[model samples]
Target: MSSTAITADATLPDAQPSPTSASRSVAEVLVCLPAIAADALPTVLEAIASAFPGEAVLVASSDPPANASDWPSLELIPYSNARTGVGWVLAVGDYAAAAHLAVERDARAVILLGDDTAPIDAPLLRSLADSVRTKNIDLVLPRFTLGPNDALVNSGLLYPLSRALFGADIHFPLPIDAALSTRLAQRLATSTQRLMALNQGSSLLWPVSEAAAAGLSVREIPAADIAPPAPPQDDFNALFATVAVSLFADIDAKASFWQRARGLPKRPSGQASPPPIAAIEASSEIHSMIETFHLAQDNLQEVWSLVLPPQSRLALKKLSELSPDAFVMEPDLWARIVYDFTLAFHLRTLNRNHLLGAMTPLYLAWVASHLRTVSDDPGRAARAVEITASAFETEKSYIVSRWRWPDRFNP
Candidate 1:
């Protein structure tokens, strides 16, 4: 897969001049929308207009709306390489095209808005833009309000792993929308180009890891609940495997940075509480998930033996015996299981797909336990999440040791 160039389409006759043309007009902010439906463009444009009034804004889209000429302040630049409508996360091609346009226009800040932009409002847009423009922060990640059962994969593994490894307390590492300073955008562009050169152009980008590796400051702002795009495939196993493989590969790549001993950053004070979510009945779901785990325990012992240590395997055995009402997977035990699997992924203890596939039952088991815990007291959902992440931070030493000496025996 050779590296491909992202060329901007010519400006519409009625629209403003191209940002790359002879005028050389600078844009204060560059907002890149991977894809936008014709009907949704008005809402997006109206939000942008309200958020950034009387300022030059460069709007780049793979699918530009027909009425782009109405917004004189917005100079539309079209690019066609982005993998639009694939998923919520921005693809490598999207970042590459946005970076090219940002550099061309000398924009001070860039906002990468993934496919769904209808939910974004004026204040949210302003917060993302102002963070990069006023403050010196390099990356601004949005923390969306979610229900107790929502984003289980992220809550179970992604948030805790990233928080523990990168020392970033962001609730959502894989966000649909984010704000990036010019320098951070350039850095991401370089990384994307390198991945493209290696024939991994369609791979997902880890912005949090990139920012952490570059020693850039990061901040997470409260955002209204923005719904992520539905999974391209309905299979939960495949989706979990895909996300875990990407994250494990990222962890393996940044081993040097996270291996060193470091203090965890203190949580910000006076944070606003998230709005309440309606309670959901999940007893049936929990029972089904528990059954899945029990089946996997009986069937996948050989595959599990290759990755989990003796103690972790014993822990899972003990957990599988409990009934759904009595089931509870301790945070510490879950952390160790994840660490061992990550090590297995790094060492290639088994086929990567098979390794991640075996993890699905374990993850479902954890989810069942988590939902059971939070269902008893809905208000404790936030505290439960905090405790889970804290356990990961506490167990960081365990992973560091196993990573350094994979062959060493453990109890």
Candidate 2:
């Protein structure tokens, strides 16, 4: 209801954490930091220290500063990073270090804080640990104060897809500051390690999916974090491709669990409303986005024909015919498009990279279509995203039937 943790009743605080279970290591907080420049390290450490004073904080990074004699009760575990980008950063060494600290220190709980995330303070960090230690919760996710325009990818894809597939309602599935019990840490570590061993170290690990599949406890805490805008050098197509590949791969790997997963996401009610975001609908790029989609229609048609049902193909064709002013991708149509793409990804109808790459423009079209449809109100974009997620849930059976009998077909 208030500051949250998405439990049955108004996040996790309403139920109260179990004191007995969390008492084992109250003073220890395993903080996983990202590799940063030397000039910035002290300020970062200070922010953490101020927020969590007098605690044994184990700060792990792929690379840590040398000559760190100044900080007390802070131990450094330097690890080797497996890949680049967020997936590489979070899934590779970062996750392993947290899991290691959780076991070795018999730590009460592990808190993941990213350098690029919004500032973390004492109360927020403590709140995350409290949820785990006091509430005896296994997973603690952050409920951020986001501007509507931020986290578009998470809104469009990660949140809805994860919700429909796993029935986990974490607002930010790939958070930099998530809390975890010992059990969750170990579970994530095992998953991460397998990916590393397979030379798929760049693979992303889905914590919410893992937690849901294992039936582990999960909670949420309030965190003040605003994601920064994309870097100038980041190409839209490439960035979207990376996330799509990871998501599709994750879905394929856990197809069985998601296939059986049912129901809408559990969105907690009554808290501060989200901040306003830019209307994709109003963006000058609608024509550009639509143009991209049309290009894909011409370029990716044969591949699309193989992946999509005839019905889906016809729907996309209709949308392609509309000008930006009139263009709209219905929620159901978008869902089927995504489901078909997921199926295509699984069936390896084309090269995986090219397959995911093809979906990016289609994704942009949906974003444009969604923004065009929703209101300009501060939280309306979120609502639009939510509606899309609901569409995904409603259409999940389509995913199931296709996933189960991918070949025995007609639409």
Candidate 3:
């Protein structure tokens, strides 16, 4: 999640404003800018300042370099929560602390950013800020256009499942960069601060779920051009476990909210456009993915049985029998498995960490099946992915039913 680099010719408006009277209420926006490489700070800072104006901006920095030191609006404070980190390599906890800072500064609009990807210009930031000011938008999330091969976990499970459950069509629910209206920011602060008090500041927070549960206004803006964030150092399994556990925990907490939510709301479809139709696996890695799935079936069948119903187990067994060259995990089957597993997680069917860990190989199986099926033109693959998401939406009733009665026999 990042913005395109700022051009040298681009200049921020330096025009300062006249002072407002003591009795006049000055409206301010909160800007949370993380430390980036030296050359990029000037452009980002200037853009933030320009977006808010002379006297109505409060910039929060964890420990900005000396180059950003001269900015008069900078509030360089050490946030303990900013120091929080999720296990392994997922370390994006800046949102919680930034929300707290926004509340402290009494800002009407608050933007939190990760150094990985940010907007280099003011217009996008202005667009988010204006939506908060005039359009009644409470949470402004950035929609990033990822490559077909990129962000597979999000493309496969996280995004689709989130959309199905929460009814917010935001592509990236936990985007590193976002703008939050005062109410939403305060809600985020409440979540993060509570985690800090419980000595779990390192735990993740789900803003989209929070907004949905509160029935607040949510909006999405395009950030397809932002350069990818700093590459993660963690490998996929640990990353999967960390993130899945966090999401499952959030779902568990918000079960009452999502279970009550009915049909998906009719709203602007802010999804990213279809990417170029090129095979993700022209030289396909289906073999390795299938191998992993096979290994899981052999070793973890007993564990999976506790979570999956007989029908799903049978589908998985059949998928297991398919040769690597002929492998295809159906979209509907995969959605059902995810739903069953989520229900199991909520029911505490087994060790939470192990439960999430077991999901990794099955996910890899889906990827293998996906790459093989889309070896031709990628348009077919995109359509298939859409079907998978639709399946999740269509199967929402199953989740609601099973969630309410975990011990009962379900399809």
Candidate 4:
């Protein structure tokens, strides 16, 4: 498509342009920036202009700035259910809106950028677009270089669970910025529509899982250290519960696909490792986390009894006895804890909120143990995460069996 200066509303002139003239204005790439800040617009637009010079690029935003007229390629679009203060990842509404805009413009690819565009540079934008246009990847996720203490929830559960279940070895499944081909955008748009129909328009969309289920190819490009947005609420427990519940629901929805054995994608060579971080003394923090676990063990036993099997309960008991200095939650035990919780979620053993709330302390225990394990040598953090992920992969059969039978008679 040829490049042409267009208005922010994405409309043509009153005098209808011929097919040849209209084709010149058709966007080659539709870059969707949902709830992007006014100040960030210039940076994002500049990046796109630099990345794809001479290509017809359409920049769409839910809330375009008043000065959008200044940018000839801007498009003002409506994104319903746009969330405020909820992290940087694109919402379901954002995906649906982008898909609609892409189809309307007949774009070949779509790049979804988060609210924060400071970390997104021209090269990164080029890489994401090239992955779709040149490499033919259906879904291109960014693998951000995060510190050891950062994104613990993703490291402890999300990554491992997605890796083991979907056989997609994507480092960051829920990324703030990603590129999608037109077909993948359409697929996720249908999902978003269904969610909206069910009044779940505000729910998160697991693009990696969706792509995996659809048998689409996915690739991860290396990204700079981009910090994730803080939780909207101060209550960490509530935050963890929300994410865990959403992921568990997705797993339950795709039970049939994940239950079938599938080969994991090969890990890409020369993966970018996180930069070295200075270790900090976290004894008090670790002690606090462990104390919370001990208290949960004492008080939430009744709730736990309903969710955990006998062997898993016994394992927690053994973990409770360990001294703070020696506290360690084995990877296998942690994996089983996650699997059992997932089963409980699927079986509706109790109130889903309560079930997930009951898991916060256990997750804290794992985090505390993880901190101690890597505190001395921060560089070992990657290796430790690999061991944890491998444990989940090794124990996949455990969850599969429990899911198939769901009999409480297991040891």
Candidate 5:
């Protein structure tokens, strides 16, 4: 993930002294984990003890078979080991379980710690608590950076894309690691029931979105060495596909408002000619993305034949094949790309899994185009993804409307 764009003002106070410092007030810190490596347990607990000695640190382990007694500070919260959705750790939903824990303990502030997850410096924790207490921020989301060769797929696509579309700067993007205020935890509790109903036995949670839409103040904290150095390949792919598809489903479910909001220009009364992609770059990634774009063209051929004007279909086919390296991506092409996703979003035909699968390749194409335009910095690439996501959010009303009622009529 990219670094946050926060500049400290004189008003923003620095982190408090060590947790052991006599002057510091006792703050309740809740550490939540699914499981932990037995060997790393000692260091993790020691770090927490040293970091927040002035504050009472409570560790809640949600692992199955509920093994968590060796560590002095750690406490095991036994939850049923029943299977849930794609990412359920223990007791299914992230916010549901988390909210239950905080409510039960009457915690002032809560922190989420994943198994095998490393802790950052004490100052980082202090910063998180300060953001909530000082700014009255309800949520503190940390920006996640790649650890060496380990890259989180969501960090690349879903995180940025979702932020842009929803106008939410969710640093963690997903439920990897986060901190929530007591009030925020309560608010999440109310939603938990609803979320459970929508998809019970699921681990998906929208803490950032929930907080943002509620108009709660949010801050992003940067953390290092939080996630395991490398996630298993199977685990990574599952996460990537799940996030991608779910996002597309979300977009598709909101398509009508977006299309209407875009105010697509009417085709001229007279005939129009197809635009050329001769200027696009032909680099390897771009080339691959372009190939993927053509594949989409083939898949959507059947759908477009029914709805698109003959001229538009032909033009789009040519546009899709334009080599990314050489393609300039004319304004109209951008509009069409937005429109296509709008259609998908409205239909919700792609479940979370399939939606993500379809989007990944297309996102790669966008990245390629952005790389050709920018200097190909991964951070820059990530930001470009956000821009595309915003394009979807711009027409939120259109999407919601069409989602409620699906019709193919041009907006």
Candidate 6:
């Protein structure tokens, strides 16, 4: 857990990558890049050649410096319209463009790489392709490390925050890593209208939201110390601007749904939810996710009360008294999570920071429930998170719905 140095377990040091299976040929893998950072290119290429063996397409969004040398394995597709924003630069330069090319080539899956990352197992590429090909997965991301520091930027903050907020845990929720299936790529390409809608007030595009909403299967793999390419790290101000703008935009889009769910007055009809994805069930890892949720609620009683209704508080308390096995199985608990998020989404649109903070515990409860459903498959668990993210996006207009119509269905 130390951020200062890479753990020996981070990368598969002596583990030799297995030869890729030819039978997994139905899918193709594409790696998206920014065109600079020649230093790590060879390593990435070599990894792809060893692991994937299939056609590797490099969708280059940025111009490589004039002095750079080109390699045959790398196919540079030019996308010129990439831009940065007031506070932060968009992480992937023209990610949409890269996604389009992959779809054009009939690629089954696409791996997005920032300048600072590398693949660990060449077979990992094949595994991603094969998963999409055979198992029908929509997206597959790898567990990543940020230099020797194992930066909090990746794990402690983004990953957990994404999980708690949306209920599905996608490790690199915002970063470019790993692969996306052809279906997912196509979904992105075709969602131009919806994408623009969600991004109208912001500079960011939540691909994670779209992928999950479409009911695509998504998962994450553990890829430790493979020496990722270097990144152009943004300073605090820029990072804050990026997060704030994107978060605010998401809040805006879901304004109506949030309002309706929270028992607030509704907004205009022009607003709508982002889109919904497949429902996530608890993983079978442990008996009941509800048990853990109740424990958390009890421990954080003060915080829970700040945001939850008296009825919800009493319900959760009553649920906790039952055995762990019995808590989450209750239909009411699950209903509360969906409703709470609907309410939380509403509160966020109002820009009520205090209420948002208060909603964190309820969000955590939902995440615990989600984890319970996907505990058996790490990949499934990740996808479930992505699914929730998709739901959250479509549910954005929930705030608007509540704001314009404040009829409490319960009372």
Between candidates 2 and 4, the lDDT winner = 4
TM-score of each: 0.89, 0.82, 0.82, 0.87, 0.67, 0.49
**Candidate 3, superposed: residue stretches over 4 Å from native:** 1-27, 37-40, 50-55, 64-93, 116-121, 227-231, 265-284, 373-382
TM-score of 4: 0.87
Model 6 is weakest, by summed lDDT over 10 consecutive residues, at: 1-10
Better of 1 and 2 by TM-score: 1
Residue-level lDDT of model 6, residues 1-411, one tens digit each, is: 111111112111113232244422333555655444566556555665566444544534344334234444445444433343421222323455545556545566676654333344666556666676677777777665443223323332344334433333576666445577766766655544344334432256555545555556667766655433333565543453355345544535644333333221333433332222225443443334454455576676765554455666787777667553333323234334444534544554334444444444444445444444444454544444444444444444443344455455222
Q: Least lDDT summed over 10 consecutive residues: which range in candidate 3?
A: 5-14
Best candidate according to TM-score: 1
The sequence of per-residue lDDT tens digits that candidate 5 reaches over residues 1-411 is: 111221222111112121333533243666665456666656666666666665556665433222345444444344322234453222325556556656655667777654245544566666776676667778887765643223434544455444544455664556555788888887776765554555553545556556755666667777655553333345644766655555554544433322333332333433233322234346775677677767877895654444344555676666676655555443244434434554554455444345445555544555455556444355544444444344434444443544455464443
C-alpha positional error of residue 266 in candidate 2 after TM-score superposition, expressed in Å: 7.8
Candidate 2 clash total? 9
Ranking by lDDT: 1, 4, 2, 3, 5, 6
- For candidate 4, which ten residues in a row score worst on lDDT? 5-14
Model 2 over residues 1-411: C-alpha lDDT tens digits? Answer: 011111121211124332355444445677766556677777777776776677667765556777566777566655333333553225644565556546655676888765443355667877887788889888888777666556677877888888888887777776655788887887776666555455554456677778888888776676656443343345767767777887788889888888777665345543223223333444676677788899998888877777788988888988889877777787778888888888888888889887887788888888777667654454677677777777777789889998889887544
Model 4, residue 127: displacement in angstroms? 0.6
The residue-by-residue lDDT of candidate 4 on 1-411, one tens digit each, is 232222222221113322343544566787877556677767666667778776667776655567666556544443432553346566675666666566556678899886563545678888898999999998998787767777889889999999999988887787677899888887876677665555554577889999999999899988765556555567787778778988999999999999994757535433323223235555888999999999999999999999989898999999999988778888889999999999999999999999998999999999998888777453677766777777788789989999999884444
Residue 51 local lDDT, model 1: 84
Predict model 4's lDDT versus the native: 0.76
User: Global lDDT for candidate 5?
Assistant: 0.52
Position 104, candidate 5: lDDT: 56
The better candidate by lDDT, 1 or 6, is 1
What are the runs in model 6 whose C-alpha is more than 4 Å off?
1-27, 38-44, 54-74, 81-93, 115-126, 145-167, 192-202, 226-241, 244-411
